[model samples]
Target: MKRRIAILGATGSVGRSTLDLVERSPARFEVVALTARGNVEGLADAAMRTGAKLAVIADEARYDELRDRLEGSGCRAAAGAEGLVEAASGDADWVMAAIVGCAGLVPTMAAIEAGKTVALANKEALVTAGALMMDAAARSGATLLPVDSEHNAIFQCLAGSRREDVSRLVLTASGGPFLGSSLEQMSEATPDQAVAHPRWSMGAKISVDSATLMNKGLELIEAHHLFALPSERIDVVVHPQSVVHSLVEFVDGSMLAQLGSADMRIPIAYTLAWPERMATPSQRLSLTEIGRLDFEAPDLERFPALRLAREALERGEGAAIVLNGANEIAVQAFLEGRIGFCDISRTVERALGEIDASRPRSVEEVVALDGETRDRTSALIAESRP
Candidate 1:
């Protein structure tokens, strides 16, 4: 039997990798739906090539262009938030939620509500509404598979072990491009330099988060939700080699780790063939060729975003939501040259302090609070500008 698949952010790095694997093993999978934010060309091409039943464009203004592009492709076209929800909740058995930022929250929730097996690449969904999303998964009997390399590694390590025997999870970070740079150098870092990740190729927003070590922090919150753990039980270490994806320690002093080449397809393939392993075109790991593996503690003073994320995780869901919302805006500002690289964490810190930390009981409330935080953070940025 073939597994039905849907990709929410088909134009992204992870999404493209998934499509590559699916394209290679055509007999094992079928792409039922494909969506992109505004890349009509890529979306249309993927939809047509995969023979997907539906192609959705999240940007309503590009609906006509998308529709025209898919006119003779035998794939139906839809646009905007409603279309994204439709794509997520369709007949696909495996849905890849890879849309960046808070915009992915609703559709991701929709997939969970529909009881679909979700490959979650969108960290914001778990970061902002961990409790709510987990509760929905529990109620609907939906399986939430972590696609981030760190969380996926932890998931694999705990596969045959008892959850009670686990002591802590160690998530490894590449430390981005500024791993060794001083605080002064980081503050003066350019957007290009920040996005120039030494290990992996990624989109701009995620690259910035990696540069500031906030990506690791967001994964910490995500691990808490996925693994039923607390902030204190999780640890972050700087592993410049990117070989050891993550580690899990047991109460008996036994530590298990998942090591692999720096490839998104490895994790994507794991989720795609759950309870079964699939072959991917990822590079094979050679410890001999790449001799020494180094590790160190993350310098909080140099990258305060990780510290801020840890603080937010300890404070609860509301603080996490504010942290993610504020960071998203700040990262965008830095990318557009409206703010400095170091100012990204500074902006998130200020928003966390100023925003009401009241916990949202529902998804609607979460969206409202996220919007409010983004607005306040934007104004705060504007006010600070000369």
Candidate 2:
């Protein structure tokens, strides 16, 4: 039977890549639904191509346009966050939780609650509510699959292995465009420079996160929850090659690594066909042609986001939520030329320091803390400006 898939954030980079795979072999999969925040044109186009049964626009203002576009196409159109959530969990065997940032959490939770296999591309869900999500998965019998390249790689390497035999999980980083730049060099960097990631193509926020090493930091926290590993057992290595997605060190003095060309489709396909493997339109790695790979320790003095992330993961008192919210705001400000690139980490640090450091008893508490931190971080940015 063909798998019925609902792709959230169908207009974004990861979403588009997934669509490419589905379109390549329509006989193997069916797109039950497609959703976008406000890009009705892209959403409608995707729905039409995939012959999706439903199209959703998270922005209510675009509902009419989306509806009109899909009117005679036999696809239904809906709007708002509730619509997005409904489309995510309605009539689908698998849900690609690709909606970027924290906005994706609720519907992603809904998908799990509805017992759909979730292909999680949104890192914030795990970073902010990994424990809750894991618990929900266990209770609801939902299969939570990793779609992020690093986490997916780690998952592949650790497949069929006993959890107790694992020693540590090492996530690889391309180190972004400012890999070897000094603190002075990064302090005056522009958003354009920061978003020019060295290896992978990603969105502005994630690209900026990569430059500050905060993406890796956030992934570290996500890894802690996803792999059930502690902060002490997880490590980040700056691998300029990015070919080695992630590694798992076994207690038996052996390290297992997953390597491939730097492409999101590979991991995306892996999740789409979990417990099985499928071919993707990704380039195969030519080890002889590449010739070499280099690894180095991240610099704490230059990229304090990594350290702050470690502290947040270790503390686990809504600290990760604060760090993520502050970083998102600061990155948006930096991208708009409102702040220097270096200020991103500084803003996150300040926001983390200002938060009450209270342990969240629920996901609602996490959102409350996230909102408070974002408000304060936005105010700080405004106050700092001339």
Candidate 3:
């Protein structure tokens, strides 16, 4: 039988990659539902192309537009948070949680609560509410497959290995666009320059996160939750090549790494065909042609976001939520030219300093803390303006 699928954030980069794979292997999967934040055109188009049974728009105001767009496509339309949750919890054997930032938390939780095999592309879902979500997944028996290339690499490397024998997980980073730039250059960097990731094709916000190295930090938090490893055991390294996605070091001194060309489809395909492998059109790695792979320690002096993320992970879940929330606000400000590129980490640092680091015991508390952090961070940004 074909795997029934629901893709949240179906218009985004990772979601599009998934759609590409599913579209290519029509007999292997059935698109049950498709959702997007506000891209009704993209959502409707994907739904129609896949013959998805349902399409959802997260913006309630766009319901009419979405519904009208899907009128004759044999796909029903819904809107707002309820619509998103409905799409997630509907009859889908697998769900791709690709909605970006904190916005993904609810729908992602819905999928987990429904006990679907979830391909997690949104790091913020875990970064902001790791413990709670993990607990929910455990209670619901939901299988979470990491979709971030680094986390997926670690996941693949750890397969069939005894967890107790694992020494550490090393997550690779592309070091982003500012890897070689001086502090002064970063301070004056433009949004266009910041989002110009050399290796990956991604959405704007994630591209900015990569540029700031906050993406890796957030991944560190995610790895902690996904792998059940402590902050100290997980390390980040700047790998400009982006060939070796990540590595897992065993206690006996052996290291296993998952290498692939810089393609999101490779990992997405892995999750889609879990317990069984599937072929993808991703470019195969040619080690001879790409002769060298260089690795360096991340420069905390230049990218303090990584440090802030690790500190937040050590503090507890509440702090992690705050760190992610604050960084999201700050990244948007930087993208909008309201703040200097360097101010992104500074804003996160300020918020972390002022916010209470108490652990959130429930999803409600996590959402509340995230909201409070975003509000406080925004006000702090305003205070520092001019």
Per-residue lDDT tens digits of candidate 3, residues 36-142? Answer: 98898999999999999999999999999998988888999999999899999999989999999999999999999999999999999899888888999999999
Q: What is the lDDT of residue 285 in candidate 2?
A: 94
Which digits, one per residue and each the tens of the lDDT, describe model 1 over residues 87-135? 9999899999999999999999999999999999999989999899999
- Model 3, C-alpha of 53: deviation from truth (Å): 0.6
Local distance difference test values of all predictions, in order: 0.96, 0.91, 0.94
RMSD of each: 0.6, 0.9, 0.7
The list of candidate 1 runs beyond 4 A from truth reads: none
In candidate 1, the residue pairs with backbone N, CA or C atoms under 3 Å apart (3 or more residues apart, or in different chains) clash, namely none
TM values, all candidates: 0.99, 0.98, 0.99
| Model 2 per-residue lDDT tens digits across residues 330-350 | 999999999898899899998
**Pairs clashing within candidate 2:** none
Show pairs that collide, candidate 3: none
lDDT comparison, 2 vs 3, better candidate: 3
As a whole number from 0 to 100, the lDDT of residue 275 in candidate 3 is 76
Ten consecutive residues with minimal summed lDDT in candidate 3? 357-366
